[model samples]
Target: MKTDVTPATVRDWFSEQPAGKLFTMPTISAIFGVAPGDERRRLAEAVRCGYLCGFLERTETASGRAYRVSGKGMRRPTLEEGDRARRKAEARLARDDRKRRARGAPVSPNKSSRVRAARVSLRAANMPVPATAVQHSVCETVEQFLARGGRVQRLTAHWEQMEQAA
Candidate 1:
Protein backbone atom coordinates (compact mmCIF):
# COMPACT_ATOMS: atom_id res chain seq x y z
CA MET A 1 0.00 0.00 0.00
CA LYS A 2 1.24 3.48 -0.82
CA THR A 3 1.38 5.32 2.47
CA ASP A 4 0.30 8.94 2.58
CA VAL A 5 3.36 11.17 3.10
CA THR A 6 1.67 14.30 4.24
CA PRO A 7 2.25 16.64 7.19
CA ALA A 8 0.74 14.03 9.44
CA THR A 9 2.86 11.46 7.73
CA VAL A 10 6.08 13.42 8.33
CA ARG A 11 5.06 14.23 11.88
CA ASP A 12 4.47 10.55 12.54
CA TRP A 13 7.86 9.78 11.07
CA PHE A 14 9.63 12.32 13.27
CA SER A 15 7.63 11.44 16.36
CA GLU A 16 8.65 7.84 15.83
CA GLN A 17 12.32 8.79 15.63
CA PRO A 18 12.89 10.62 18.93
CA ALA A 19 12.44 14.00 20.57
CA GLY A 20 14.87 16.97 20.68
CA LYS A 21 17.16 15.73 17.95
CA LEU A 22 17.04 18.18 15.03
CA PHE A 23 13.85 17.28 13.20
CA THR A 24 13.18 19.75 10.37
CA MET A 25 9.97 21.80 10.34
CA PRO A 26 8.80 20.01 7.19
CA THR A 27 8.70 16.74 9.07
CA ILE A 28 6.96 18.42 11.97
CA SER A 29 4.46 20.09 9.62
CA ALA A 30 3.68 16.90 7.76
CA ILE A 31 2.69 15.22 10.99
CA PHE A 32 1.62 18.33 12.84
CA GLY A 33 -1.28 20.62 11.83
CA VAL A 34 0.62 23.52 10.33
CA ALA A 35 0.14 24.57 6.68
CA PRO A 36 3.10 24.29 4.32
CA GLY A 37 5.44 27.27 3.58
CA ASP A 38 4.39 28.53 6.98
CA GLU A 39 7.16 26.26 8.22
CA ARG A 40 9.65 29.12 7.84
CA ARG A 41 8.42 30.67 11.04
CA ARG A 42 8.56 27.29 12.77
CA LEU A 43 12.11 26.85 11.58
CA ALA A 44 12.98 30.27 12.91
CA GLU A 45 11.60 29.25 16.29
CA ALA A 46 13.55 26.00 16.16
CA VAL A 47 16.62 27.99 15.33
CA ARG A 48 15.90 30.16 18.34
CA CYS A 49 15.59 26.95 20.37
CA GLY A 50 18.91 25.77 18.96
CA TYR A 51 17.28 22.73 17.40
CA LEU A 52 17.82 23.46 13.68
CA CYS A 53 20.36 25.06 11.39
CA GLY A 54 22.11 24.29 8.11
CA PHE A 55 22.34 20.64 9.00
CA LEU A 56 18.63 19.89 9.10
CA GLU A 57 17.83 20.67 5.51
CA ARG A 58 14.29 21.06 4.17
CA THR A 59 12.88 22.55 1.00
CA GLU A 60 9.56 23.91 -0.22
CA THR A 61 7.93 22.60 -3.38
CA ALA A 62 4.84 23.33 -5.49
CA SER A 63 2.97 20.35 -4.04
CA GLY A 64 4.33 20.08 -0.46
CA ARG A 65 7.32 20.20 1.81
CA ALA A 66 10.28 17.80 2.19
CA TYR A 67 13.08 17.45 4.74
CA ARG A 68 15.99 15.40 6.03
CA VAL A 69 17.96 15.20 9.28
CA SER A 70 21.28 16.95 9.49
CA GLY A 71 24.08 18.20 11.77
CA LYS A 72 24.03 21.27 14.01
CA GLY A 73 24.18 24.75 12.42
CA MET A 74 23.53 23.46 8.94
CA ARG A 75 22.48 26.32 6.67
CA ARG A 76 20.57 25.30 3.60
CA PRO A 77 19.97 27.63 0.70
CA THR A 78 17.42 30.42 0.93
CA LEU A 79 14.18 30.80 -1.03
CA GLU A 80 14.31 32.44 -4.43
CA GLU A 81 12.72 35.85 -4.95
CA GLY A 82 9.63 34.60 -6.73
CA ASP A 83 9.07 31.92 -4.12
CA ARG A 84 9.57 34.40 -1.31
CA ALA A 85 7.05 36.83 -2.82
CA ARG A 86 4.51 34.04 -3.19
CA ARG A 87 4.93 33.06 0.44
CA LYS A 88 4.63 36.63 1.72
CA ALA A 89 1.46 37.29 -0.26
CA GLU A 90 -0.15 34.08 0.94
CA ALA A 91 0.78 34.76 4.56
CA ARG A 92 -0.65 38.25 4.38
CA LEU A 93 -3.95 36.93 3.10
CA ALA A 94 -4.12 34.30 5.82
CA ARG A 95 -3.31 36.83 8.54
CA ASP A 96 -5.79 39.36 7.26
CA ASP A 97 -8.54 36.78 6.97
CA ARG A 98 -7.90 35.64 10.52
CA LYS A 99 -8.05 39.19 11.79
CA ARG A 100 -11.25 39.91 9.95
CA ARG A 101 -12.88 36.83 11.42
CA ALA A 102 -11.70 37.70 14.90
CA ARG A 103 -13.22 41.17 14.58
CA GLY A 104 -16.59 39.61 13.70
CA ALA A 105 -16.60 41.44 10.42
CA PRO A 106 -17.86 40.11 7.14
CA VAL A 107 -15.10 38.36 5.27
CA SER A 108 -13.75 40.25 2.29
CA PRO A 109 -15.07 38.93 -0.99
CA ASN A 110 -11.99 39.60 -3.09
CA LYS A 111 -8.49 38.45 -2.35
CA SER A 112 -5.81 41.04 -1.64
CA SER A 113 -3.98 42.45 -4.63
CA ARG A 114 -0.96 40.34 -3.77
CA VAL A 115 -2.98 37.16 -3.91
CA ARG A 116 -4.61 38.28 -7.15
CA ALA A 117 -1.22 38.95 -8.61
CA ALA A 118 -0.06 35.49 -7.60
CA ARG A 119 -3.13 33.93 -9.17
CA VAL A 120 -2.45 35.79 -12.36
CA SER A 121 1.08 34.42 -12.46
CA LEU A 122 -0.17 30.92 -11.77
CA ARG A 123 -2.70 31.29 -14.55
CA ALA A 124 -0.12 32.57 -17.00
CA ALA A 125 1.85 29.41 -16.46
CA ASN A 126 -1.09 27.39 -17.83
CA MET A 127 -1.26 25.40 -14.64
CA PRO A 128 -4.59 23.69 -13.99
CA VAL A 129 -6.67 26.76 -13.24
CA PRO A 130 -9.25 27.84 -10.70
CA ALA A 131 -10.39 31.36 -9.82
CA THR A 132 -11.19 30.89 -6.12
CA ALA A 133 -8.25 28.55 -5.68
CA VAL A 134 -5.89 31.07 -4.09
CA GLN A 135 -6.67 29.97 -0.56
CA HIS A 136 -5.77 26.35 -1.21
CA SER A 137 -2.66 27.46 -3.05
CA VAL A 138 -1.72 29.49 -0.02
CA CYS A 139 -2.19 26.43 2.15
CA GLU A 140 0.11 24.47 -0.11
CA THR A 141 2.60 27.33 -0.03
CA VAL A 142 2.58 27.31 3.74
CA GLU A 143 3.16 23.58 3.61
CA GLN A 144 6.21 24.21 1.47
CA PHE A 145 7.55 26.59 4.08
CA LEU A 146 6.88 24.00 6.73
CA ALA A 147 8.88 21.49 4.75
CA ARG A 148 11.70 24.03 4.59
CA GLY A 149 11.73 24.38 8.39
CA GLY A 150 9.45 27.40 8.82
CA ARG A 151 8.42 28.46 12.30
CA VAL A 152 5.93 30.79 13.93
CA GLN A 153 6.38 32.03 17.45
CA ARG A 154 2.95 31.81 19.07
CA LEU A 155 0.45 33.77 16.99
CA THR A 156 -0.20 36.15 19.89
CA ALA A 157 3.44 37.13 20.10
CA HIS A 158 3.53 37.49 16.38
CA TRP A 159 0.57 39.82 16.41
CA GLU A 160 2.06 41.94 19.15
CA GLN A 161 5.28 42.29 17.22
CA MET A 162 3.37 43.22 14.13
CA GLU A 163 1.40 45.83 16.00
CA GLN A 164 4.54 47.31 17.46
CA ALA A 165 6.37 47.20 14.18
CA ALA A 166 3.46 48.87 12.46
Candidate 2:
Protein backbone atom coordinates (compact mmCIF):
# COMPACT_ATOMS: atom_id res chain seq x y z
CA MET A 1 0.00 0.00 0.00
CA LYS A 2 1.08 3.58 -0.50
CA THR A 3 2.17 5.72 2.46
CA ASP A 4 0.23 8.80 1.37
CA VAL A 5 -3.55 9.20 1.53
CA THR A 6 -5.24 11.30 -1.12
CA PRO A 7 -8.83 12.51 -1.49
CA ALA A 8 -9.27 10.44 -4.64
CA THR A 9 -8.05 7.29 -2.93
CA VAL A 10 -10.28 7.86 0.09
CA ARG A 11 -13.27 8.48 -2.19
CA ASP A 12 -12.66 5.26 -4.04
CA TRP A 13 -12.42 3.27 -0.81
CA PHE A 14 -15.60 4.86 0.58
CA SER A 15 -17.48 3.97 -2.57
CA GLU A 16 -16.47 0.30 -2.47
CA GLN A 17 -16.92 0.18 1.28
CA PRO A 18 -20.42 -0.17 2.65
CA ALA A 19 -21.88 3.10 3.91
CA GLY A 20 -22.59 3.77 7.62
CA LYS A 21 -19.75 1.59 8.98
CA LEU A 22 -16.07 2.41 9.43
CA PHE A 23 -13.37 1.03 7.14
CA THR A 24 -10.80 -1.55 8.22
CA MET A 25 -7.01 -1.10 8.00
CA PRO A 26 -6.16 -3.46 5.13
CA THR A 27 -8.92 -2.08 2.98
CA ILE A 28 -7.79 1.43 3.78
CA SER A 29 -4.11 0.57 3.30
CA ALA A 30 -4.90 -1.05 -0.02
CA ILE A 31 -6.59 2.11 -1.18
CA PHE A 32 -4.34 4.72 0.49
CA GLY A 33 -1.07 2.74 0.56
CA VAL A 34 -0.40 2.80 4.28
CA ALA A 35 2.62 0.78 5.42
CA PRO A 36 2.09 -2.32 7.55
CA GLY A 37 3.91 -1.01 10.62
CA ASP A 38 3.67 2.49 12.14
CA GLU A 39 1.86 3.85 9.12
CA ARG A 40 -0.99 1.43 9.64
CA ARG A 41 -1.14 2.35 13.33
CA ARG A 42 -1.17 6.04 12.45
CA LEU A 43 -4.00 5.58 9.96
CA ALA A 44 -5.96 3.63 12.56
CA GLU A 45 -5.43 6.41 15.03
CA ALA A 46 -6.89 8.88 12.54
CA VAL A 47 -10.00 6.71 12.38
CA ARG A 48 -10.20 6.41 16.16
CA CYS A 49 -9.91 10.16 16.50
CA GLY A 50 -13.26 10.45 14.64
CA TYR A 51 -11.80 11.62 11.36
CA LEU A 52 -13.21 8.34 10.03
CA CYS A 53 -15.88 5.96 11.29
CA GLY A 54 -16.95 2.34 10.84
CA PHE A 55 -20.28 0.47 10.66
CA LEU A 56 -19.85 -2.76 8.73
CA GLU A 57 -19.28 -6.15 10.28
CA ARG A 58 -15.77 -6.72 11.65
CA THR A 59 -13.87 -9.25 9.64
CA GLU A 60 -10.43 -10.87 10.00
CA THR A 61 -8.15 -11.09 7.03
CA ALA A 62 -4.66 -12.41 6.26
CA SER A 63 -3.22 -8.91 6.77
CA GLY A 64 -5.30 -7.64 9.71
CA ARG A 65 -8.81 -6.75 10.87
CA ALA A 66 -11.20 -4.01 9.72
CA TYR A 67 -14.73 -2.59 10.26
CA ARG A 68 -17.37 -0.64 8.33
CA VAL A 69 -18.98 2.66 9.27
CA SER A 70 -22.21 1.81 11.06
CA GLY A 71 -24.81 4.16 9.59
CA LYS A 72 -26.62 4.64 12.87
CA GLY A 73 -24.98 7.92 13.83
CA MET A 74 -23.35 8.58 10.46
CA ARG A 75 -23.83 11.94 8.78
CA ARG A 76 -21.83 14.15 6.48
CA PRO A 77 -19.56 16.70 8.16
CA THR A 78 -21.10 20.15 8.71
CA LEU A 79 -19.62 23.37 7.34
CA GLU A 80 -19.15 24.74 10.85
CA GLU A 81 -17.00 21.81 11.99
CA GLY A 82 -15.01 21.95 8.77
CA ASP A 83 -14.50 25.69 8.99
CA ARG A 84 -13.58 25.63 12.68
CA ALA A 85 -11.15 22.79 12.12
CA ARG A 86 -9.55 24.59 9.21
CA ARG A 87 -9.22 27.76 11.30
CA LYS A 88 -7.70 25.89 14.23
CA ALA A 89 -5.24 24.07 12.00
CA GLU A 90 -4.28 27.32 10.31
CA ALA A 91 -3.73 28.99 13.67
CA ARG A 92 -1.60 26.09 14.89
CA LEU A 93 0.50 26.13 11.73
CA ALA A 94 0.94 29.87 12.02
CA ARG A 95 2.09 29.52 15.62
CA ASP A 96 4.54 26.75 14.73
CA ASP A 97 5.88 28.84 11.88
CA ARG A 98 6.42 31.74 14.27
CA LYS A 99 8.33 29.50 16.68
CA ARG A 100 10.42 28.22 13.80
CA ARG A 101 11.15 31.72 12.49
CA ALA A 102 12.13 32.79 16.00
CA ARG A 103 14.66 29.95 16.00
CA GLY A 104 16.07 31.26 12.68
CA ALA A 105 14.25 28.76 10.54
CA PRO A 106 12.59 29.58 7.21
CA VAL A 107 8.83 30.23 7.01
CA SER A 108 6.30 30.94 4.31
CA PRO A 109 5.71 34.52 3.15
CA ASN A 110 1.95 34.46 3.62
CA LYS A 111 2.18 35.45 7.27
CA SER A 112 0.14 38.54 8.19
CA SER A 113 2.03 41.83 8.50
CA ARG A 114 0.90 42.19 12.11
CA VAL A 115 2.21 38.79 12.99
CA ARG A 116 5.57 39.66 11.47
CA ALA A 117 5.81 42.88 13.52
CA ALA A 118 4.95 41.13 16.76
CA ARG A 119 7.62 38.58 16.07
CA VAL A 120 10.18 41.36 15.67
CA SER A 121 9.12 43.08 18.90
CA LEU A 122 9.08 39.84 20.88
CA ARG A 123 12.58 39.04 19.66
CA ALA A 124 13.81 42.48 20.74
CA ALA A 125 12.28 42.84 24.20
CA ASN A 126 11.00 40.79 27.14
CA MET A 127 8.38 43.29 28.30
CA PRO A 128 4.68 42.41 28.23
CA VAL A 129 2.93 44.40 25.57
CA PRO A 130 -0.48 45.87 26.43
CA ALA A 131 -3.46 43.58 25.81
CA THR A 132 -4.86 45.74 23.00
CA ALA A 133 -1.59 45.53 21.08
CA VAL A 134 -1.27 41.85 21.87
CA GLN A 135 -4.66 41.05 20.27
CA HIS A 136 -3.53 42.79 17.09
CA SER A 137 -0.02 41.29 17.52
CA VAL A 138 3.04 43.46 18.34
CA CYS A 139 4.74 43.14 14.98
CA GLU A 140 3.08 46.15 13.33
CA THR A 141 3.87 48.53 16.19
CA VAL A 142 7.49 47.48 16.30
CA GLU A 143 7.82 47.79 12.55
CA GLN A 144 6.21 51.24 12.59
CA PHE A 145 8.52 52.48 15.30
CA LEU A 146 11.57 50.99 13.61
CA ALA A 147 10.57 52.42 10.26
CA ARG A 148 10.45 55.89 11.89
CA GLY A 149 14.03 55.31 13.11
CA GLY A 150 12.91 54.99 16.71
CA ARG A 151 14.72 52.59 19.01
CA VAL A 152 13.53 50.95 22.19
CA GLN A 153 15.18 52.25 25.36
CA ARG A 154 14.97 50.79 28.84
CA LEU A 155 13.63 53.33 31.33
CA THR A 156 14.65 53.64 34.98
CA ALA A 157 11.89 53.54 37.63
CA HIS A 158 12.12 57.29 38.29
CA TRP A 159 12.01 58.16 34.62
CA GLU A 160 9.02 55.88 34.07
CA GLN A 161 7.22 57.44 37.04
CA MET A 162 7.97 60.98 35.84
CA GLU A 163 6.76 60.16 32.33
CA GLN A 164 3.55 58.71 33.73
CA ALA A 165 2.97 61.89 35.79
CA ALA A 166 3.43 64.07 32.72
> Best candidate per lDDT, number?
2
The digit string of per-residue lDDT tens for model 1 on 73-135 reads 335444578997999999999899899989998776565856987888988998765777345
Q: Candidate 1: lDDT of 127?
A: 75
For model 2, residues 86-154, the per-residue Cα lDDT tens digits are 998999998999899999986777658668888988887987767664365545677798889999886
Root-mean-square deviation of each candidate, in angstroms? 36.4, 21.1
Span of 10 residues, lowest total lDDT, candidate 2: 48-57
User: Which whole-number lDDT from 0 to 100 does residue 160 have in model 1?
Assistant: 92
lDDT of 1: 0.55
Off by over 4 Å in 1: 1-77, 109-166
